[model samples]
Target: MTAASRPVALITGATRGIGRAIASELARTHHVIIGGRSRAAVDAVVAELGDASAFVADLAELSSIADRAAMLPELDVLVHSAGLIGPHEPIAEVNVDDLLQVFTVNVAAVHELTRITLPGLRARSGSVITINSGSGFTSHPNSSVYSASKFALRAWSDALRDEERAHGVRVTSIHPGRVATDMQQELRAMEGGEYREDDYLTPAAVAQAVRLAVETPRGGNIDELQIRPQ
Candidate 1:
């Protein structure tokens, strides 16, 4: 397909890790739009993908989302890959500011972006992919805050899936376990555990799951995909 006719995919947090892997994978079939907080990082990925472009904005800054979403009048796929893993601590000691920060980026931002882009997605009968985590289903001892955000994200995705089905739009939530990304590295550090790269799932593996969800036949939809390392 020619450039103008190709499907458009916008992947937030596309600067590195799972987001970058997803952008690269989709670039082969779609004109990828890389989204991230750093213009340089997004541009570098765009340069590497060749057929891709950049959308630089901080998801934490919710007010900027509307204008950024405006720039994309047509979007075939929206991937909510950007997230924040706030300080892992017990709920008793968690600061309100940190809780708000985590929820604002992980839940609120995702909702706003999806809301703004629903029309474009519905127009094309497109898909929305949420790069969720195992925490959404099961929260650990000191992971209450981060896990809460993921749980909320999962709930939103579930609600959106049913709400938009009649509109011919597909919504999917992908829950990946222990991916070997920078986030995992930081998580390991926080827990004072050894960083074992080989023991974790690769970013590309998670990206492939996303591709499958986005490419599923029109009549059928993948509500959620749970991926874990054997």
Candidate 2:
């Protein structure tokens, strides 16, 4: 099928982890656009997923995001999987720079990208799925900054859902428990413990949640989904 005729999905952080899995899953039915910081990495994933394209953009860099968003004509699905896990320090020890950086990527970027893409999404009656974390609803020791960013994300998703419902767009926040991705490995290492893959959910599992939200009927909106390891 020609690219113009197929449904299009743009997945940020598509180079690895849950983003990559979502890209792969959507590629079966949609023309996936792989969004990532590294062109080489995006290209590699595109090569792996035959029916996909690449749009390289670093969420941390604000200037280029607008330009990249303009390149997209219309988008059917916008999956926000690009995020940062800030320093795991107690509130007393948390660095201001670290907090700002985490919020910039996890919150601001998501908001701006959605804003820029709103027209296209509204035109297509699309779906927006954000990969929020279980930390969004609860906080643990030394996780204040990360949790705060996620809480902000949750608020954004909620507001967006209400605002876009009249336009026939679906907004969903997916809060997944610890996923056995490289990020989890890093978190485990920071805690000075062994990283066990079996202890967490796979990226594919999280990707399935995204697919379910996207595939729901236009009249049905799955606003929030929380998946945890059994």
Candidate 3:
């Protein structure tokens, strides 16, 4: 099929892990735009994906998003996978800078991206999927900052779903537990424990959930999907 005829999907954080997996899955039939902060990393993933392009922009820098958004003529699927897991510390010990940084990327960026892409999404009745975390539902000790950001993300997705449903845009929030990614390694290291891949969900598993939501019937919307490791 010609590129113009194929649907376009933009996946942030496509440099590695779950984002990369989702990009790969969508590239089977869609024109994938691999979004990442690092040009080198984005280029490498695009090279490996064969039928994909690169979108290098820092989500924390809101100004850059508009510039990148202008380059997208039309978008059929938007997957928000870029996020930051800030320093794990007690609520009383949380630094204000860390909180701001985490929220900037996790919540603020997602909001802006969704806003900027709404028109394109509406034109095609596209799908908006945010890769949320299980922490969005429940918090744990020393996870306040990350959980707060995710909780805010979930709220945004919920509101967006309600507001955009009238315009034919489907918004979904996928909450996955303990994905086996570099971020998981960092979390385990912070707790002075071993990182066991066997105990965590694979990135491909989360990608499958994204594919399912994106490929749902035209009149159906999978608003929220929660995947936990058994």
Number of colliding residue pairs in model 1: 0
What TM-score quantifies how close candidate 2 is to the native fold?
Answer: 0.97
Q: Tell me which residue pairs clash in candidate 1.
A: none
- Report RMSD (Å) for each prediction in the order shown: 1.8, 1.5, 1.7
What TM-score do all the candidates reach, one by one? 0.98, 0.97, 0.97
Q: Give all candidates' CA lDDT scores.
A: 0.93, 0.93, 0.92
Q: Model 1 segments beyond 4 Å from truth?
A: 1-3
Runs of candidate 2 exceeding 4 Å displacement:
1-3
Q: Taking the tens digit of each residue's C-alpha lDDT, what string does model 3 give over 94-193?
A: 9899899999999998988888888989998999999999999999999999999999999999999999989999999999999999999999998889
> Considering lDDT, where higher is better, how would the candidates rank from best to worst?
1, 2, 3
Candidate 2: pairs in clash: none
Ranking by TM-score: 1, 2, 3
lDDT of 2 at 102: 96
Selected candidate, larger lDDT, 1 vs 3 = 1
